[model samples]
Target: MTAPEDDAAGALAGTPEEQRAALERWRLVLGEPGQSVLAGGQLSEAGAGRDAALDWLYGRDEDLERRGVRQPRHGGDGPSVVTTVDWLDDITTLFPKETIERLQRDAVERYEIHDVVTDPAVLARIEPNPTLLKAVLRTKHLMNPDVLLLARRIVEAVVRQLVEKLATEVRHAFSGARSRTASRFKVARNFDIRRTLRANLGRYRPEERKVYVETAYFVSRTRRHLDQWQVILLVDQSGSMTGSVIHSAVTAACLWGLPGVKTHLVAFDTAVVDLTADVDDPVELLMKVQLGGGTDIAKAVAYGAGLIEQPRRTILVLISDLYEGGSEHRLVRLVRDIAEQGTKVLCLAALDEDADPAFDRDMGRRLADAGAAVGAMTPGQLAAFVAEQVGR
Candidate 1:
């Protein structure tokens, strides 16, 4: 009997090897039901390992049960039970780097399989990425000292990547635009190519089609901030705001010790804790953060307001979902009072890479009405806003 021509088979229906590989891929995608139709009731040994690794993570999804797809059953001569470490091993060994990373992300983020990070064996094997870093933050309390030590490597690696990425944005925002006037200093980075070309245009030789420069124009770099300004970052440490907490720590670290800005990093749940001392070390700051509790945004905001050296020059960034566990009326009134006094109040719903925030819209609108800017922003965008405010 001729094999049925499904989309997978039809698209790659060439040699027998290509057809088999495509069908195996489709089998993996379709789960257990695709076995008989796509792979003819069997998969190669590597294919079986890959299938088991995927099933280990995706099989726990309750939606599959609701969709009438039964979870893949093991044992009774099938593959053995896939422990977290074993699954990690199988995926890292059987899949490519990209596929392995995706599987690892699903295991921790979508499945909430804490063992992926909590287990030292798995932590040692898994690649360090943002998703894994978040998982570590959420579950770090569950780890022993040894596992926590291993988890710190993931934190450091991921935080270093974030700092490198954000530091560039911070530098650009704070680095003043090139001045039009020429400078005596001859720094290579401050070289004004456009101004130099314009200035040396008189010496251009038509025969050689090259400009013979008698003088090189170098523009002096100006500092954006002239007066001292305080940046009070009141970050909510509720369970839902872990991503925000991570970004806030990194943002504070990037903003620390600028020419004219003093950064205060305060984390709040029911109570507020000042984390400014640790702001220079984001890896340490993030390690010290407690990521789950009832949110008291008003209390945090009040604490931040107290830290303002100059009300007119301060930028109070309240990073939370606005699900206030404290008095909502007090929060709105406080924000309005601060904004009215010339303080820049920014209520960030999210401060992560995606910036896709799920926050209380009504409360956000209420804060906006109170003169506080309510929106979601990534770390880079927040730096730019702060830079603009400081420059002004």
Candidate 2:
């Protein structure tokens, strides 16, 4: 099985045999987790239709029952739901608390999530309704890239719901919302001695009320207006960020789904490819993208900056490994200029996709000084930041 490792080597080319061999090779990358899920009917059941060739992934083909399950196999019915669940868990951790609730709801209804997991209630609901199970299969993995481009369709139902919710929430919050006093700030204003003390007669003496208001003074919240903004997330399509790239791209797509917020995505390696239009169909966006090229942070950033005619309201997020094929200084200069232009510039040295260090510390520091903060952001943190930045 390991011998097939070479198959994942070449690009998306070659004959049937080579393609099959390549699928097998990439399948090897799945290791045990990949096998467990794929072996359990994930391919055809959850991974078919999009790209027929993608069906070749991980020994999963037409009839899963034919080969039989393997390695601690305990199948009461259907393949293991662990893979999809695990992916969901990862994505769950990437969103904010409010967003997570929304995501959970989306997963449950849109993906028919209850049916996909080995839960009895879900099985009962779908046992009578076949369409329910079909829906479940569609949204099994919203954040996994290895599932092949074809399998991505299953994610649309849930993703669309989630994206719409997030986009709408964020867009409305950013574009239409007026600054409201924060809860803490509200607490502060409400704690005026004259107001609270008047309500609480003998229960609160002047000193007591003073202590109360002063003690609660820590809640000095001010009105931090939710501002309207446009964000362009440029993801590095290089192999390193493959997992994160997929997740972030989907995140970017969801942003595009909303009104008001101008979300643009440009994936890069040696050359820059503006994926703004492709956000409408993430699968096509990804298919159109071919990973593995030299990193050119400057080119990618500069391209994004050019798209922003009005910089002050623009939020530019560069998700990359930070290696550069182009001149590092030019990239630094571009970042500085964008910051000077009043763009809310930020560079994520590496989106929480992979954990291989590929950034230039000196360059990262320079960008930081230019007002572009750099750090790794978990998916949830990224989501929260996006929401907060846009006033969601």
Candidate 3:
């Protein structure tokens, strides 16, 4: 009847049950540190399980040290502490599917907890997503034969999703544009209803309230006749470039064996490795990638250059952060030479879903001056660019 008390814990403006629920939500949000501030320090059975699950992941944050809050250690001298398996079980039981995924992702990516994917129990229980897939690629080497088998499921699932999505973009880009000239082939997809109606408008019958159609116009597909134009993707396999590396592999797979284009995938760190042989199987190619090392953009570029048969018919895409470790001068000179020789050079700083790139601006500028287009692009955008270039 009367207004309930409200404080830092939360507003207790409803029934007693609702009031307790509000307090528990606040407790989970504020974490272990807020227990002192809450009116009732005790948590319900479900509430305590949820709290332990949340703490298992977020409590590992080093920033808690600055706040003077010591995180509770699990599996110590305590009898009922949460281990990785226990945390997984607790979160999956107490939280929804989405929350469980976030927790699993945080454990693998944020906390560097390889056990999430390495342990058979945890790997089987976890959901397959892009973040988890990246983690699997990074740590699959650490996994034994049995664990690697489980991790492959994550790779295949994530790669299948990527291929399905990117395949549409590639199909649309290469589908060809409609031309004004009438096509001899009367395909339903290329039917131009607007042009057909306008072309036969003079034959409209007012009494029937319909136009007497004479000839149906079909839109002609206009595409350039390409002579085996090569698309060489030089990807940097540095730790920071993992996203780009993953996307590049998938993109190459999608672009593989297209009528007018030949796809080449090359991954590099300090050394260059031509992955074109395995480009068709992105999952295998990604598994073989070693994600951390010094970057040598020049060495990779030189290797890509050697693969070029006809300079005018090649498109060299260098996917990297542009932090050249080999020779900066040599890198710039190679790019300049390649661009001047009629090769379409595209220096992409990043090639993932998020086009936001972290690259060396000075180096990017020099590459631009060397006649290479320098910028970040999503996989879809890159597909469109390739379509346009090949069409030209």
Candidate 4:
């Protein structure tokens, strides 16, 4: 009759039997460390199976003995990597989906898997998720020419898939904006049927049951606005933003392809690299991104401002954690100046799928007070926001 949460709490803090059972479960998950909780306790056969699976992931006793090493030293490699494919496959069966994902991420960080992922055998053996994919792209600078090319292919595939998923909604939102009503004097191809009906109601011949059409309602023909609006995707390429960098690159490419919008992507980390020329190719654009460096956000903001020829027709999207390494006062001043000049500025705390991101709330508030909209959003949501902005 107890709720699952209550059952869980009972297992951990209930009767002695229940506590012992829960301790056995912990031993399975925490391995050697967990064994201390159940030092004199024993597990049932089923519990033993669970313990073995946990040991497979967290236990390093056997691995240490074989490799003749303890834990990894600072800036040094681990004793020996547990093969990614084997570990992931095993954990996938044993753990819940979220737990499996967490374990996989841990394994990646623990094993330095990105360095070897380019190998044909390794690439073929594992399923690459977003986190791993981001890691691969992040390490492109260290890869050889051949391996780098393979990494680009992987990035392109992932980006292409995202584009496919987002293309329809983006086009729809953008097209809806271009469907503005034409002036009454100038007959647009799109007919204003309701308006025409209202204007001609007086001319309705009730006796004959005929409404005479003195004026024809012609719908305005669809117009494509190529290079009419400018979109600047100013991304922060610091160490913590690797995932954001990858997704932002792909989103920038999508924005670039949309008619009537000229998209410019500038990635910053103390230095700015304008990848506008390669905007059409997300793969190439992402390859040029350098992930770890100090952040000079004010300078990047200044550079982005310089690109705006017409502030009224531009949208500046600044993606970052908002930990400004440069002058905060100057950054605030610049943002306020741009907003006052009629530029539509949006400061995204992050542009990744993770809902809760660690960002500077104080800075976000300051930017918002200065007329910038600040929040964390996924790429798809960002595309939707862009579509809404352009549509207006």
Question: Comparing 1 and 4 by TM-score, which wins?
Answer: 1
What is candidate 4's local distance difference test score? 0.74
TM-score of 2: 0.49
Candidate 2's residue-wise lDDT over 156-252, tens digit each?
Answer: 4434544555455444433432233323454433444444444545455565553333333112323324455688898887766665565566677
Per lDDT, what order, best first?
A: 3, 1, 4, 2
Ranking 2 against 4 by lDDT, winner? 4
lDDT of 1 by residue, 1-392 (tens): 55543545657858888888888888889888677656445888999888877877888888888888894444588646668888887887899988888887887777788998998888888789888998899999999999999999999999999999999999998887455667899999789898879989999999999999888889776668689989999999998898899999999999999988899999999989999999999999999998887888899988888898889999999999999888999999999999999999999999988898889999999999999998899999999888877776
Angstrom error of the Cα, residue 306, model 2: value is 0.9
lDDT of 2 at 371: 81
Against the reference, the lDDT scores of all candidates come to 0.88, 0.57, 0.88, 0.74
Shift in Å, residue 202, candidate 3: 30
Top candidate, metric TM-score: 1
Residue pairs in clash, model 2: 50-150, 94-379, 94-380, 95-380, 138-154
Flag regions of model 2 displaced more than 4 Å: 1-228, 353-358
Q: Which ten residues in a row have the lowest lDDT in candidate 4?
A: 67-76
Model 4 agreement with the true structure over 144-225: per-residue lDDT tens digits: 7887766666677777776676666566656654355555445453577787787898899989998787876644434455
Arrange candidates by TM-score, descending: 1, 3, 4, 2
Report lDDT (Cα) of residue 280, candidate 3.
97
The residue-by-residue lDDT of candidate 3 on 66-145, one tens digit each, is: 67888444465656656788787788789988877787778877899989888999888877888899898888779899
